[model samples]
Target: MIKTNRIRMKAKPAGNLSRDDFSVEAITIPAPASGEVLIAARYFSLDPYLTGFMRGWQGPDPRWAEGIVVGRFVAQVIESQDQRFAPGDWVQGEGGWQDTEVISADKLQKLEPIPGVPFSVYLSVLGSSGLTAWAGVNGVLKVEAGDTFTVSSAAGMVGGIAGQIAKKIGARVVGIAGGAEKCAHVVNTLGFDACVDHHSQDLQGDLATAAGAPITAHYENVGAKTLDPVLANIADRGRIALCGLIAHYQDMNPIALKEFRRLLISGVTLRGFRLPDFAADFEQASAELKAMVISGDITLQETLSHGLESAAGAFLNMLEGKGTGKHLLVLEEK
Candidate 1:
């Protein structure tokens, strides 16, 4: 028998989740039965959306139970009773906040090798965040060649990919991140045409300069404060693909958006969606993204922390915009 480590919610969080909101718990790993596999979690992903779950936010699912800590992760099959997979195969699944778990083989996605791309891409660029970005830019917004696009939380997993994918389609992409360093990385490292720091003293002015014309499309990941600025700069008849709202994740305090009605008056279209709601298109997006990554057209940056013990700290840091790219916690050896 094997022992596993998992992080469970200490209690339902009030506002701005802290380390006290979670605790590490130990559990026994059961052997795999027929059609089941025992997975050793390799990389556990920490996303800001988890904080909302900890706070009893129902998300898109009004029927979902409150305070449930649900998440996605990369794991390796340590033991399997299924014919499709064998021990030592790398897979991705909803591992929650754990180091190891036993789930049905059907629950996992088997990762195939792409010549140049690392396996981590399954947890990042070709994974949920990347797929979400692809769906938003290509499927929803449908950015066209020569269009101007703006993305909030530009240095984040989804935002960064959306920026790159927009640029790939020949659109001029601009990003808005929290700090100067992340702002620089988005433009210089991520190949965004321009980047704006939301923390800048003159954010509206900086955003106006980076926007480079009326914004044809805005990939909205940060809500409220950022959304208002984005609305002010959007072109008439512009489009918006609303993804996660991390800025308001901590504080659900009602933000009176003075520009809330701009969507109607400006003839802008704002589409809000959760990624899983469009999971049917994931396979198509995955294939396209894997090709782009293998060709070195896009880069995946991950800040990996050691052990399940670090999940809380890593998650909080992500909320504070301290970590760039995907924030991950390495659980154990694959």
Candidate 2:
């Protein structure tokens, strides 16, 4: 057995998370057992869904509080009992927030990476975040030419990609984002037709004017904060991919949107989705997003937090929607 140690963070969020809430400890990392691989984690994907588990939204879940928090990770295989994954292979999957993880073969997917693409992108654009955007834009909403596609949280990982995908497919894309800078990034960087700051006093008026025509499609991420204005301008029979309700999730609050009635009044179709719902489309979405990213059709945005210990703060920032793009932890470099 090749011996090694791992730094793992055990989180117990009493209220909102804090650095103190995360207690880092060092433990022995076991060598891979049969059909398992020992991995050295290089990057961690700090996403909002984790907050639910930490807060015990569903019930008492020890995975988040009493034990090492679980999340998607990119890692290098250091030892492998599985013939499919040899030493030095890079993989992505459900590895907890630790410096090294001993994951079963089934929990890991070998990455077929494009030349020059950073391994970190596998956790961001070319991974599940990109897939979520693809499913929301291409699968649920089916955005197409001449459509006014509006997406909330437009400067975010999924929302940015959704808008870019819509724009690429000839849709007039508009974004609803939190602040002025985020709104500008949604417009200038992601190439959306227009972007409205949700914090604005006249969000409804501004969004309607920016959209010009009735919104043919909406890819929602933020919940109540941006939903009402977007709903007010949605076209009759338009579609909505109810993606992440980050506002609700981060705050642990129930959704009560003013324009929810528009869903009924305008006869709009709203479909809430999880990745498992479109599992069959994962391969296609991953391929298309990778191609677009390589060809410069799709842009990648991310905030890198250095070190495994930084995971808690990064998770908090991501949940609070403080930064644009994917919030990631740099385990290898830090």
Candidate 3:
């Protein structure tokens, strides 16, 4: 018998998620019943969406139940009673914040290894974040050559890929990140044409200068101050893909778009997306992103923490703009 450590959601968080919100406990691993497989977690994806879950998600019924754990991890199968997967196979799915879990073999999406590609890519570039970026650029923005494109959360997982894809399409790429260092990373490492530092004093002027002419496609990842400046620099008939809004996470107060008059006059198009709605095309998106990554056309970076105990701290760091890049947690050795 083996013991497994799991991070369970113990309480509904207040405004910001604290370490107390999660409770780590050890449990005995039961035998894999028929059609089940036991897995050891490899890399867990720590995303901003987890904040909503920790705060007690409000659905149509507004049910706030707190029994199950929160998080999504990529685990490798270790023990199995199902024929579908043998030991040492990696998978991408909801494994929660646990060192090991027993999941139905049929429920897991077996991942194929990419030659010379880092396994961590399964959690960033080739994972949900990367797919979201692809969808926002190709599907929502409909970005074309010669278009001026800009994205917020520029150094983040999705934002970096989104900006690069736009650049690959022959569009001018401008990014907006938190500080000067992140801005430099977004521009120099991620290959964006220009990156605006939102924390700088002359954010509006800097963004305008980065835009050069006018932005034709905008990939919005952060709201509040970032949105206002991007909206102000949009060209006529610009398209906006409304992705995650990280700025208003602490206050939940919706930022009033005072520049709606510009949106109207400029004929800008805005579309909100959640990504899972278009799950059918995820495979295609993954293939395309993998190609770019393999060719060294795009780069990825992450702030990885070891173990589930630091998950809360990582989340807080991300919200506070302290994280350098995509933040993830390494649960245990596979």
Question: What is the C-alpha local distance difference test score of each model?
Answer: 0.83, 0.83, 0.82
Model 3's C-alpha root-mean-square deviation from the true structure amounts to: 2.3
**lDDT of candidate 1 over 2-108, digit per residue (tens):** 78777777666666678887788887767888999988888877877767666774544332253335578778888889999998898988855777788899989
Tens digit of per-residue lDDT, candidate 2, span 58-154 = 3233444455677788888888999999988889987567777788899788987678778889988887889999999888998889999999889
TM-score of 1: 0.92
How many backbone clashes does every candidate have?
0, 0, 0
Candidate 2 C-alpha error for residue 262, in Å:
1.8
Ranking by lDDT: 1, 2, 3
RMSD versus native structure for model 1: 2.5
Residues 172-291 of candidate 3 have per-residue lDDT tens digits of: 999998888898889888889999888888777898898898889999998857877878888999899999888777677767875768789899899999898779888899889999
Model 2 misplaced stretches (Cα beyond 4 Å): 1-12, 57-62
Error of 1 at 305 (Å): 1.1
Which 10-residue window of candidate 3 scores lowest in summed lDDT?
Answer: 58-67
Error of 3 at 278 (Å): 2.6
- In model 1, residue pairs whose N, Cα or C atoms come closer than 3 Å (at least 3 residues apart or on different chains), thus clashing, are none
Q: Which ten residues in a row have the lowest lDDT in candidate 2?
A: 57-66
